[model samples]
Target: MAKVIVYPPTSMILYDLVERMGHKALVVSEAVRNLVTASGIESPPLNVTPEEPKKGLRYAAVDVPSGVRGRMALIGPIIEEAEAAIIVEDPGWLTGCSGCSRTNELVRLLIRTKGIPVLDLSYPTNDDEAKVFVQKIRTFLEGLK
Candidate 1:
């Protein structure tokens, strides 16, 4: 099994789907941590305060807008550590937020520049909608096998 670190904005639906598939996922935000734990997914404490990259961890961000501002503050460490990143295309939150748009662009740039495989999950409202995203994640993890 491969070690996987899951980033923020992941709903319980998505988190449970990933964990139930027998994969390791780390929730990166306090809010997400609470969400995952509330949903009965075991999650470790992630110190996003310093925002330093954790060595030897493969990261999969849930969406382009990770709620962090500025390029360096957001993508700097994640890009350094991520083997692959999953971003939601046409994110539901981006519709009314200009900040999200900028963040999305930075995420795209980092993935492209680092040559990390980026799986676009887009918008998934239900379990069925999340299946394709889950499959993409599984496929990406399989390639590492």
Candidate 2:
């Protein structure tokens, strides 16, 4: 099965669609789960471990915001591991809002330049468009080797 990274990373619908299509979805929630569940993380929020930003240096510069770096720490590796990707542009706030414009742009840049098969689709605004979105995703996933 292909390891497909979905943009925004927080979209459960994208995650479910990828899995339902017999592909592995590399998502942020799973990365966060790993961080919080990993031994020695004592932070109260448990959102970003101290070492996470350091790990992010591989993808971003030291001068970048810690938030972006921290996020990249989780997402960068997933992008590297992606065999394919599905990015829904202009996703609704409730659907796939990641809250970091810089990180979002960076993530899109990295994924697009990664040389893998990527399917870029617009967020569906109505029932008809939603049906087309799913069909497009299914077609793209099926095309992946």
Candidate 3:
């Protein structure tokens, strides 16, 4: 099965669709799961490990904002492992807020440069648009080997 990275990284709809199509959906929750469930975690106060910031440097420079670095650290590796991607642009705040615009842009850039097949879609505003959106996503996913 293809490893499909969904833009926004937190959209369950995209996650579900990818999984439903028999591919693995790479989303932020998986990273969060690793952070929280790891045995070395000390407390619930912080979500990040000391190594995260350092790992992030591979994707972003030290001078960049720590937030971007932290996010990239968690997401960059996922992007590297992606075989394809599905990006839903300008999704409503509730649907696609990754909370950092820089991170979002960087993530998209990384995915696009990965040389994988990418399906870009706009957020649907109406029932007809929504149906088309789903169809496009389904078609693109099914086309993957």
Candidate 4:
């Protein structure tokens, strides 16, 4: 089972999608313990500790980048571990925030330089498209095996 960390905006959507695809999905948030608890999803708040940052971690962001200000608190170790990153497309959100765009650029750079497998699920705008995105994600995950 792959351990997945999903970031916000559409965290729940990604969680549900991963779960539907028959994998264990763990949602990660920052200082939103109560909100995450209320969502009834298994989530842990982002806290940089010294314990290897949880190995075998995979991540999926709700949009091009995750978190407010595009500040990804959990990318460093994951990148070092060469974890798979799934980037969802949200052009409007990316354009709305410069921080998001910068963060996205960083993510792309990390993926390309580190040779981490990246899946761009940018074309699913509707329910049908979302289904296809889920299938694509599952395929990517399978390839990781």
Candidate 5:
């Protein structure tokens, strides 16, 4: 099984697709889950400190425009440990797209340097494209090993 990282910090489709194909989808929500569960307070809010950014550590304080360093604090650790990646983006997706272009570019650059197979896709607009997209993704994952 491969550890594939899905970007946008929140893409259920990519995450689910990875898991359904017998791969692990390492997403930010997992970190959020850890933070929430670590407090031992199964509640809506998590008690996390937003300290200075540090490499290989989770940074609760997420600042979009704080440059790549700040944004990396939120995702660098996950990228560092990822075996593969599936990055999907769509200009129409307001919420799923990166808020900062520079930060997005930095994330893509980091993914490229992971020396792993990456499936970069554009969100499908039609049913035909959707099918083809999924097929490509499945092919990419199967070829990973």
Candidate 6:
């Protein structure tokens, strides 16, 4: 099965679709869920881990800003592991985009460099578009399998 990386990092529709098509979606939502479940307390540490370097580094081991490091760590590994991609860029929804521009750019770069099959799509603005979105993604993923 191909490993499909879905952008927005939290699109449940893409996650479900990937699984339904017998593929895996590398996403951060599962990380969030694990954090919450493991915390068991009212609050949890936000993305801080013992392994988190005091500074951030690029995939090449070149040092970068800590902010960029934090964002990269969220999905860099997934990008490398991905066998394919389903990018749903919905610029109209302010909150639907990545956390910042740097992360967004890096994600696109990682995906592009991999030279894998990809299904690039935009976020649907209406119910009709939503339906089309699902169908499009389904077809793309099934074709991969």
Which runs in model 2 stand beyond 4 Å of their true positions? none
Sorted on lDDT, best first, the list reads: 2, 3, 6, 5, 4, 1
- Could you give candidate 1's per-residue lDDT for residues 68-106 as a string of tens digits? 442234344545655555555665643222244555565
After superposition, the stretches of candidate 4 with alpha carbons farther than 4 Å from their true spots are: 3-10, 19-73, 91-99
Pairs that collide in candidate 6 are none
- Single out the weakest 10-residue window by summed lDDT for candidate 5: 52-61
Ranking 1 against 6 by TM-score, winner? 6
Alpha carbon deviation, residue 79, candidate 1 (Å): 2.0
The C-alpha RMSD of each candidate to the native structure, in angstroms, is 9.0, 1.1, 1.2, 8.8, 4.1, 3.3
Show where candidate 3 strays beyond 4 Å.
43-46
Flag clash pairs in model 1. none
lDDT of 3 by residue, 88-123 (tens): 999877775678999999999999999999999999
Give the lowest summed-lDDT range of ten residues in model 6. Answer: 47-56
Best-to-worst order by TM-score is 2, 3, 6, 5, 4, 1
lDDT by residue (tens digit), candidate 2, 48-119: 867888999999999999889988998999999999999989897787756798999999999999999999
lDDT of 5 by residue, 12-93 (tens): 7788888999988887677666666774555445433433244323422345444445446657778877999988776255
Q: Candidate 4's C-alpha lDDT?
A: 0.49
- lDDT of model 6, residue 126: 86
